[model samples]
Target: MTLQTVRSDILAGTVVFLVALPLSLGIAQACGLPPFVGLLTGVVGGIVVTIFSPSRFAVSGPAAGLVTVVAGAMESLGSFSLLLSALVLAGALQLLAGFLRAGRWICLVPGSVIQGMMAAIGLLLILQQTPVALDTDGDSVTKIISPDSVLVALGALLILALWQTRFIKRSRFLGRIPGALMAVLWGSLMVLTNDYLVPGSLADLDRLSLPEIDSFSEVAAQFSHPEFSAFWRNGAVWLTAVTLALVASLETLLSQEALQKLCPQQPQPSADKELLAQGVGNMLSGCLGGLPITAVIVRSSVNVNAGARSKFSVLLHGLLLFCCGLFFETLLNTIPLASLAAILMYTGYRLAHPELFLRQWRLGAVQFIPFIVTASAIVLTGMLTGLALGMLSQLLCSTCASHRSAIQLSSYSNHFVIRFNQNLTFLHNARLRDLLAKIPDNSVVIAEYESAEYMDRDIWLTLAAFSEAAAARGIMLERWPRAEDPQLVDGGVH
Candidate 1:
């Protein structure tokens, strides 16, 4: 690469690194795992995933959307090592799916359903983090109330909100700095200030906890390994594996699609290749005792906006995360937990914003119903169950709509012509039979299939049976392009 390209990559890489650091820790905490594991996942996403993925700007890491799945799996499995085993299997499933070229099918998932899933995840984050933000560590409200913690969270949140304003965004220098990094810095600075001034006053405030490793040499002790025995012994492990594979693969494909839109100048990446890259990253991360990984839109967006022109930026960011875990654990532990909670709460708000709901509602019932149902189900039940219910609801709505508009009946006196307006399938067979039986006796009817895109054998059989009975009822039924004509293809309409 040219010198200019190298310089651009370095700058972009630094920006992405800054954005990923605090978020990674927060995501791990949200999943009830060690803060270091989240950073490890980011490292794998940046280095390993970047090496294998085809997209130039795609950035991989732990995503907020998977928080529910990861938390539930952790609880059900009852051990981090057990969860790692499931994660490894999830990665293997993704690898198999990639080899099978299943990535393309992700496009068939409705946009509404995807949005609903995100909104639900966002709502969950808000609910889950509110107590943390408030620093409510005790059962009683009086004992749980910690003014110092609440102040820190609110101050960090205010800083984040102000950073997103048009005035700050228009500033050339401030706009380039990620708001998340700034929030973390603000929290750290507050802790330092309190320690130097009135340390005993804020002693009750909780801070991030990490092992007291003095040097890079001791960092290896933090690495974890999966319990291989859990793979076969616990059926829940397999269920968790399936859930992770499906969700991670879907999120990765969706991120790739979004990246394509953001960087239309860049050639589209192979979807299957993207899946393979993600699979490998998760497998490696699991082996090292890290959380599951996926192509995350937040980091990728930061990478692109910061002028990343190659995967070098992503790789560089990963290296930075590795170094952070080794040398910066002491400084990292000084960050207050309330600050991270605020950051996560803000992220959740963005996902389940009022505007997102209003936008879906404006799209009409067909889209809004599924979107709301998916979000509600996910919040009330769980991710997989909610998605299944949402898909079923969408299918029912789409089928009803198709049945209403799929055919048209036009009657000119006793001469009735039935025109197929859309594709015919088994689902339409019953409706077709009902319409045919309504035709009056001694009537002349015409069966038209020229407009239909596709016709199933069941539909054709229904038509043939109607034609047979038409003659007995003195109703003459004729085909548009005679049945013997070459244009009348079998099982398909042209």
Candidate 2:
């Protein structure tokens, strides 16, 4: 690569590194794993997934969308090792799915449901992290914030907001600066300055706790394997694994699609390939005691907005994580949890931005209803349940929304044409028969399949029989199919 290209990749990677660090820590804590595991997932995802995936701009990591799922799985399974086994199983299933081309059907998922799911996940992040941002741990949802954290978090959010404004985006210098980096750096610097002043306050602050190492050589020793004690013996564990596989694959594909929209020039990712990459990453992560990994949109978006040019940026980001984990783990620990929470809160807000709701609302009821239903359902129930409900809503709408081409009838003088506009399936056979019977006496009826390339033998046979009874119905019947010339014989084209 050219020197300029290397510099650009380094710049983009640095921005992504700042964004990924706290998120990795927070997501791991949410999943009941140590901060180290989450960071490790990011490192592995950037390094491993980039090697397998075709998308040049997308990045992978422990996704915020899976925070609840991972946390719940660990709680139910009763062991982090058992949870790791589930992740390993999930990864294997994803690999199988990719091999089977299961991801090819992703287009069948409605965009409305996808949007709704994203909004729901965003809201979930905000709700779950609010307590952390306010610097209060509790059994109750509403806890009074610590006086010190309130300012730290607010200031961090404000800095992020200012950095993301249109003015900054249009500016030559500010545009190049990542908002996440500015927020985190400013917040960390202020905290460090205060800690320097107070001497002992740094020891009492809630910081990201990570094991320290002097060099990159120690990184290998930190890797840990999963204990597959509950495999096969517990159906629940298998079910959870299947759920993880499906969810992780879905999230990865969806995030890939979203990022492609932001950078349309990048080569589109193959869903199956994406699935394979994620599967391998998850498997490796489980082996290393990291939380399950997916192509994360937040970090990917940050990478894009920071002007990522190629997969080099992804590789560079992973390298930074690896280098940081070894040499600067202590400095990262100096970052207060409240500041990280603010960063997450802003990330959450961007995912479920109010303007997104407005844009969808303008698309009409067909879009807005599903978007609102999915978001509300997710907030009240959970992600999968909410998605199921949203899909059902869309199905009902589609069934009610009939079309003229679904079944049409035309007439010219004594010639009444029974036209199959597009689809001529068994499902429309009854309607075709009804229209055939409605042909007036002494009129010539035509069973037309000229516009439709497909039709079932069941419908064709019914037409054949009806043709024989043309005399009984006082009407003459004919069949016109593309496979043969128009036939006006004693019976149908059968």
Top-lDDT structure, candidate number:
1
Q: Tens digits of per-residue lDDT for model 1 on 339-359? A: 998999999999999999999
Total backbone collisions for each predicted model: 0, 0
Query: Which window of ten consecutive residues has the lowest lDDT sum in model 2?
Result: 482-491
List, residue by residue over 318-434, the lDDT tens digit for candidate 2. 988877877787787777777777877887798899999999999977778888888888779766678889998877656434433466788999888777766566777777777
TM-score of 1: 0.87
Q: After superposition, how far is residue 387 of candidate 1 from its true place, in Å?
A: 1.5
Estimate candidate 2's RMSD in Å: 5.4
lDDT of each: 0.88, 0.79
Candidate 1 Cα RMSD after full superposition onto the native fold (Å): 4.1
* Candidate 2 residue pairs that clash: none
Candidate 1, which segments miss by more than 4 Å at Cα? 137-143, 215-217, 409-419, 423-449, 452-494
lDDT of 1: 0.88
Best prediction by TM-score: 1
Candidate 2 TM-score versus the reference:
0.79
